[model samples]
Target: MSTRREARVTAARAIRSHAEDVVRAALVALPPRERTRRGLAFHAYQRQVRTIMRADPVAFEVVETRMLAEGHRTSVIEVTLRGEVGVDAGDMLHVLWRNDLDRIAAADAVTAARFWTTPIPHRPSRWARVGASGLLESVVDLSASTDSDPARAERITPRFFTVAGVEASDVRLQVTHTAGMPPRAASFLARVRPGDVVEARVLPHPHRVAHDGPGLAVVTGSGAAGVFAALRAGASGIRLVWGLGDKQLAPWVQEELREHLRAGRLSSLRLALRPERVTDLLVDEPIEQMAWIYVSGHESMGAAVDAALRARLGESVLREMSDGLRCIVST
Candidate 1:
């Protein structure tokens, strides 16, 4: 007889396999009209397929499997869904399944390589344009503000975790791409093209300056949303801390930021490995002066940096934001 663990693994795999088949069948049977009405659900299942072709089986690697009380069992699977053209890099699918009474309760695709449990609603994208080194920018326009002048351009809300731009009455966004993206974010990236005039929503918020004093901006994967916010707010001194893996999009981004450094808009820029501690970037009197801080990056590293910043600078001075590995650290 097989061990209890063995039986659970086998059962979990079977459940996952059947679920994949059902999703595929549902997608194939979905007509154009039905897709329009239930596009959200159908599109979601379409993305769950790991292979490039719809006919291929979903490739799920069992990362971990565990048994629970009441005959319940859990399985964590790593899924990789490749795009026809391609994604930036490090894109894969992650999901958890609970098996009980021969039925499985499936969860939403976590989508991010890093652990980002929080889910945010995504508005339809107005426009999408691709830039250097696999950088995809999603644009959303708030159009004109009713509370303020219609002719005057409205500025984007400066939220630490999200990257956005507002110029000429347009709001631009650059989501930090990784190996695997959330279902909604991936679908947005896949369908968006330049000058398409798509529909999308704009997340609004109150804008605030980096801080009362000089600030240090630490970023990992984002295209420097915080830095732009700081400059727009007329920050005098700014620093950039960055890191990346094999797919280094930073070098291309650094060129754009260089002009700011040369123009004296930035005080300093440091590139370090993800494993390095945030405190290593501190130098001279800045540590003691209580500089305002922003840290953004992968959930794992970002959390570590946040902890370190809080320890070194305290919670009052440090700010952080991210959607999984998609993050932009800034002041």
Candidate 2:
């Protein structure tokens, strides 16, 4: 191995050792009940680190530590890896710290804490419906408002994750928001390595329209991932409509959409600033001839779209519905 490769391997070993120590110390300080609850997750994280170290050989170093509200501190870690490893550092960090941040802080005698990793590219996986069986890569929080109820907002704000180990020609990312891309969405996009070819469309709220054909897909709400799945399955055209309710349109939103239009990925895009019903944004298009129709965002929207499609197409359309997004494809 070259000198740099040797250094990375050595650093990776050191990180593994330190992580083991930290986890051990944290476990010892926890009460038995808490320990039992956290031990499994902690060990699973450790194993993930070990897996990366053994196969990919990456080095991890803390770049910055920031103090947050309520005495919490977040540490930003930069990951360095050579070649393809099929590991998403950001998603790994999410699995490591999202739910366990508070527990880690309590055991370590620090404040509530979080962890984040800078963007790094690995490999792509098989594209399927958002909730379909695949290696879950990242869960992007798409909530637009602070007052939005988590339970209710989760239905509309889609979680975007990628499967691993598939050779794909391209990766398409669709982001819908009232103003511009959310911070979380930007972060998720940032993680795409500089070398990856990603076609990203940032659009305003969509008002539904009629479908074209098997080569076409219409996505309402936040089901961009459904379009991605369609693209992977060789769908040639995509229509994205954002349902922003009564939110005010920011000038930046249109500028960004114009930029995407210049770059060209969406077959058509629309923005609806004010709509009579938010659920109507789900599937306003006539779906008799559509090859794939995806409605994601709200449960009520999913039901309405499903009912409408069923009423029109009867049982001929194969349907897959999840809590967050719904997929309807012709057999």
Candidate 3:
């Protein structure tokens, strides 16, 4: 996200709480001493990837930390880090030992040689981006009370994890390839069975700040991963609803974005917010990120609220739904 506003904490918490988790490769063993060099180096490499994510976490669909530095000439690891962000030679060896580093390509080579000459790290964790908006670029170590839930996401921890994209789909459509999709639209489509067609729309939010030609989009997916991915994919402005699922996180998001925009601290601003619902409609206005908004549930309910938002935000920008991510051409 741009320096335009601060990231909201409550919104973040809501999404984190409600997000569905799917784990991948839960077993990662620590590397031996000889591999320590590569381990540490790979750790630093992961740090570089983290920085790229910090810059814009969801820039690419998949950014393998191991493939970094090796010059994986042909792959989706679009972001690169060197100079300040990349690691040192000694640090590289440390990565070899961390078990975070693994060489997936090498057939037969000495562990030491792999440590020294290993261009890419060995079998590292999978960094796949799903849909959702309002993901922080960096991985923050937030102090979490264990009483809080940390669902099926054994892959990335809830405390250290940040929001990405809110978009979802079982059919594997590339929302990042285009612009963004609303959370409801994405969720509804994500429920589609294999090869099934569902209509989705990458509509521009009415109150949302627009770009010159194409207008902007407010992304909705499961977590901050989608947010990072959407931002990385070049969506103009985003509705950071995933992480900031409610108004508590709203101030945090606002503050963070404002700090980024003003290039100053907003601690002195003394802004306060209270989430209130008016007649079954949640109401918290005067907030900049979202305007005149009431999150509606499913189809019929969605239509009623959608009509209101459409009137307020504009029906023109609110393009009709699309066939959610069924082989749409990507740039």
* CA lDDT, every model vs. true structure: 0.35, 0.32, 0.23
Candidate 1 deviation (Cα RMSD)? 21.3
Model 3 lDDT tens row, 177-273:
1123221222222222333322211211111111211211222211223223334334433332221122232333444445523532111122112
User: 44-109, model 2: which lDDT tens digit per residue?
Assistant: 544443334333222222222111111012111111212222332112211110111222223212
Candidate 1 lDDT by residue in tens digits, 163-204: 232333333333433334322332233333444332221222
Residue pairs with backbone atoms closer than 3 Å in model 2 (clashes)? 125-163, 125-164, 155-297, 156-297, 205-242, 206-241, 206-242, 209-285
Model 1 off-target regions past 4 Å? 1-161, 180-183, 206-213, 232-234, 250-252, 274-285, 314-331
RMSD of every prediction = 21.3, 17.5, 22.0
- Lowest-lDDT window of 10 residues in candidate 1? 1-10
Cα lDDT for residue 44, model 1? 48
Better of 1 and 3 by lDDT: 1
Query: Model 2: residues >4 Å from true position, as ranges?
Result: 1-222, 225-235, 247-256, 259-264, 272-275, 278-284, 318-331
List clash counts for every candidate, in order. Answer: 14, 8, 85
Off by over 4 Å in 3: 1-225, 232-247, 250-256, 259-305, 313-331
